[model samples]
Target: MRKEQRVKKNKEFQEIFKKGTSFANRQFVLYSLKQEEAQPFRIGISVSKKIGNAVCRNRIKRYIRQAFLELREDVQDNHDYLIIARKPAADMDFHEVKSSITHVLKRGKVLKKTSYGKNDRKK
Candidate 1:
């Protein structure tokens, strides 16, 4: 993810927390705030000490970033997103993290609906 696409400031995170709408699953909480201007989406991630040590928290953060990278095209482009990882996330691998984030995005109605071709079908 590019620096421009990340929400790094404490102020920004607080604004999103206060004004954004949130969606959550068992493993993660997602906060989304739509921007008035046209720009690429930005994301902020928070992993608490309660989840694990630095290594474990970093791993979960990495997984979440990678998941967002892959889902970038499908996600709305003019919003700021904040993801907070729960305890169950520490034990999950990359794929689990991706699917869980996808689930949250879907519930939040932030992911675009893509029409799949016949050959594009899974299986």
Candidate 2:
């Protein structure tokens, strides 16, 4: 993701938490707000060092980015989303991370239930 597409700072995160909405599951929290972007939606990923070392955090971030990349079409367009990795996410595998993040997105109404179907079109 580019600099303008990502939510990188603590203040940006907090603002999203404030004005945006959120849904929490066992493995992650999805925070989102509407953006005026013209193209497809963009996402930001955040994983704290408190979870583990740089390696662990990067692993979690990679899994999440991959999950989102795979489901980009099913997600609503033009929304700014933040996927915050929770502690439980560290113990999960790739599919678990995908499921957990998908669950949160579903709960947030950013993604429809049928979005999980394997036959769904790619973005």
Output candidate 2 Cα RMSD. Answer: 3.1
Error of 1 at 54 (Å): 0.4
State candidate 1's TM-score. Answer: 0.93
Cα RMSD of all models vs. native, in order, equals 2.4, 3.1
Model 2 C-alpha lDDT per residue in residues 3-119, reported as the tens digit of each score: 565667878777788889888998898888887757667677888887888989999988988888778778887788988888888888998888777778878999856656553
Best by lDDT: 1
Q: For candidate 1, what is the lDDT? A: 0.92
CA lDDT of each prediction against the hidden true structure: 0.92, 0.80
Please provide TM-scores, in order, for all candidate models, with all chains considered together.
Answer: 0.93, 0.83
Residue-level lDDT tens digits of model 1 in 6-115: 99999999999999999999999999999999999999999999999999999999999999998888899999999999999999999889888888888999988771
* Runs with alpha carbons beyond 4 Å of true place in candidate 2: 1-5, 9-11, 112-116, 119-123
- How far in Å is the alpha carbon of 27 misplaced in model 2? 0.6
- The residue ranges of model 1 lying beyond 4 angstroms of the native Cα positions read 115-123
